[model samples]
Target: MGIKIIKRQGQTFKDKLFIPAIMGGMKTTLGHFTKNLKDVSNLTTIQYPEEQPTDVATNPRYRGVHRLTKWEDESEKCVACYMCATACPAECIFIDAEERFDGKAEKRPKEFKIDLLECVYCGYCVEACPCDAIRMDTGILSFTGSSREEFVVDKKYLMNNERAKDLSND
Candidate 1:
């Protein structure tokens, strides 16, 4: 049996004129514009700062602010392996490793810092961590700072931030 091919007819004079397509596009545009203009609530865009989306902190998979996890003893889980720092493509992560005096581990981060301004939120740091020390599940979507220094978060801030503590309940 031979396959039958049906060819589409050429464009009519109306289609060739392009008036119908233009009118259709304009109709769609005007419909949305008028609908949104009449009732602003009809729009799906969330008014940030004043009106936060209800789904902000509800999703576990949502990546937001970065945080450092702690052990049951309240010690930092980061062994200062520098995996996160190395994996960070933005070079936002900075870590100063120091030998542990208590002899519990070979090294620990004396100073760990992340520049939120430079971070691209790629979640590479979290994936690179073998100890589950780093996480981006703080559910913090808004970060405002008056100065550059305010955006640079240190180890102390990451470990003690309220957003970081919220993950424990999950």
Candidate 2:
């Protein structure tokens, strides 16, 4: 008679273990599915504008909006140092430095324009400010423009925002 090898028919230890494990995994997934459908945990969403989250204020070092700070005389805090421009990964900050009238010791930006369209909100400019003139605290997360030209914000526009004025609270 030819040698006959019988194939393993019954469930082996690995097979038995794997089947239960799969069933357990499926059960866990189904549990999650049912829980998700109910959503009693209140962990999935935010109330947005009405119930503004406390995460930003809680995190003191958190960077939010971009602000072009001003001096006591209401002049720009920016010395036209160009550090922000250099630090930008998106290359969005553009400055035109000019000596103040009557010849001040420091140069000032005659034309400080930031292309918001190109800005990645990386907060590099805020960090690069040596004079603490520029900050990310206006809390402006969204901006819209009718045209590309409108998106290129000038110094006046950045410093003149209503939200920025609220920062002073005077």
Candidate 3:
């Protein structure tokens, strides 16, 4: 079989000079500038921490903060399976499982921590969970901390997050 070769057209004077492309770009820029000048609201500047953008839309499927789900007894649903920690691509999840002494559950997480700096928010940990113990639907887009140690979220904080309570209202 013979290969079919396609012919290409040569550039015109306007294309060679790039005058039309430059004019089109300038027109678009001038239009946006004039529109923004006419209506200040069209500008994308936001005074963060004091004033948030009202027109901004958040994604429903956005994975933000992580929270541990609770059982009916108000105890953590996580059985210390370490599936979340194992599936974490960033290795941000850490779990230390220990046998329960009170006979309430077979095993419990002695220490569960997640480094926010290292977490990629990929939601793989939520998918890898067998008991649906973890969820990333807190709707918290910001996680501010003064120090590196403050970014590390332990099991206690995960279980009693204020954002978790806010999620129930929605």
Assess the local accuracy of residue 37 in candidate 1 as a C-alpha lDDT between 0 and 100: 96
Taken over the whole model, the C-alpha lDDT of each candidate is: 0.85, 0.76, 0.83
Q: Quote each prediction's TM-score.
A: 0.75, 0.66, 0.78
Model 2: pairs clashing at backbone N, Cα or C within 3 Å: none
lDDT of 3 by residue, 1-170 (tens): 89999875446876788888899999999998898889997566767857743332145566888999887778888899889999999999999998876666699898999999999999999999998889887766678999999999999989986443333333
TM-score of predicted structure 3: 0.78
Ranking by lDDT: 1, 3, 2
Error of 3 at 63 (Å): 1.3
Q: Which one wins by TM-score: 2 or 3?
A: 3
Residue pairs clashing in model 1 are none
Using lDDT as the measure, which candidate wins?
Answer: 1
How many residue pairs clash in all the candidates, one count each? Answer: 0, 0, 0
Cα lDDT tens digits, model 1, 1-170, are 89999977646888788888899999999998998899987668767898866576767677888889887777788899999999999999999998876655688899999999999999999999988899888778788999999999999989975554444464
Residue 45 shift from truth in candidate 3, angstroms: 5.8
